[model samples]
Target: MNTARLAADLVEELDEGGLRGSFLVRDLHTGREIGIDPDVLFPVASLIKVPLAAATAERIRLGELDGSAQLTVQPGRISTPGPTGLTRFRYPARIAVDDLLYLSMSISDGVAADALFGLTPPAEVNRLLRAWELHGITARHLLGALSDTPAERLPAEEGHLAHSLAISSGTSGRGHRIQQLDVARANTGSARAFVDLLQALWTTSKIDAVVQSRIRELMGTNLLRQRLAPDFTSDATTWFSKTGTLLNLRHEAGVVEHADGQAFAIAALTESRISAVHQPEAEVLMARVARVLRDHLRHG
Candidate 1:
């Protein structure tokens, strides 16, 4: 394969596929890069699972959380796509934490994700993100609502007093404005930072070595079999990936390894102005980009 030509073609194909966003493709071996914008943060969508998985695994390693504990599913866990998660259950459902994680990452299960958010409260998530040294990564407001807050009986004037105090403290109005807004954007991460995380996963550093292996296994087991995997599967090549899609946005970030153990971590994210249900346009772009990146690394 003329890998250089393919890489150039990938850029043209992205434009034709109704894509409108920034992206980055790097050669993990030689530290080469190919893309227009790698640092600009695009809505991460389900790609947020990467960090969530890391945070959860770290928690498990620290003995702060139990992975095998059973968690009861509630009705409110259901959420809309793009701004929310993928729902797999309806009615009162109960599942183990281990199963919940399997469903969340492997199946991209939204219900399972909501259950996880509840189990690992937002405060804990914030703590975990900071511990990981990841900046600009945190749960959105809706996800934050799942936190534990006790309701106390108070006079009606207490609400007014609280608002007055918040305004006095200069913290209340800022949060209120941010909350009432419904900007349907996804999560954010840079190409370089993302690859650094992937390298950490590959080397089993910055998190529990055992849990990182499990994370890799979950990525390999991802059920979204229609996109990048179809074009680039081989017995000699292994692709550990987490794919994300919502409306006109399609993203796939993973490490591709050849038979000789040479590997590269790549992330290709695209956003199209016009929305497509099956997202055939966006998928085409992703496949092209994946193929180009793989071919480039395989030969170089």
Candidate 2:
């Protein structure tokens, strides 16, 4: 199929799946790429952890922060996570920066991220990205700010009400009544922006080589795989990715390397229009769309 027809069909498929998304897949070697609205900015949710990890790694590389230095995390400092991590601890625990990076990136642990944020503020992370020549991503607040949304305030069964509010309360210009969903106010990035970061991490870039290597390793260890990982991971390939989900948003960005030395960096940032949160079909749609784009790029 032609690129135009393929893009049109992908957009229709996304809308049918109750998703409006920005997607981009670029060959790491040739730099050839394809996408749908890849430049449109969106609130990035937990995907911001990638840069957070990168910045923290940079600090450690520069000896400004000690990766081995242990920091104390008091019990109940953060909300208990859905799975398990620091928030479940009944007593104060001392963890090194290196281990915290694992929890934050690999397992999407907000408490660990907030701890790292305490060490390196959001503004510092933003400064590091800019200094490294990465653009279009803004880190404004720590991960704790994300937990304060309506989704947390509502009762268990009424959770969809928050998702309903998230769907209905949005402006044409991407503004939302919810601060976390608002691009100008929340931690945000575009599909293109994330692809650029992946490129930098996967290849030579302004980010220090040591820091980049560490960041890539953290991503390779990512445990949340139900999103795009299923489509990308294989015995013959490696998918190093990070997933972000907040309210109606779902995003994952990573580089997939094939056995024959070919690599593709892909970013899929999406928002759901459906009110109910448990949309496994939406996740499937995202993975299918992204894989189609990767297949197109690989063939042509």
Full-model lDDT for every candidate: 0.60, 0.91
- Model 2: per-residue lDDT, tens digit, 178-285? 999998899999999999999999888898899888988999999999999999989999999999999899899999999999999999999999999688999999
Clash list (residue pairs), candidate 2: none
Question: Taking the tens digit of each residue's C-alpha lDDT, what string does model 1 give over 1-300?
Answer: 464565466667766765654555566667666554566555555666777777777777778788888877765433332223335235677677777778778877656776777767545665766665656544553232221111112243343343233223223222222221112322456555566667667764556688778788888888776777766668878888887654344677787777887777777766554432456656766776667665665565
Clashes of each: 3, 0
Q: Which predicted model would earn the best lDDT?
A: 2
Instruction: Indicate the residue-level lDDT of 259 in model 2.
Output: 100
In Å, residue 1's CA in model 1 sits off its true spot by: 12
User: Which whole-number lDDT from 0 to 100 does residue 242 have in model 2?
Assistant: 95
Model 2 clash tally? Answer: 0
Off by over 4 Å in 2: 76-84
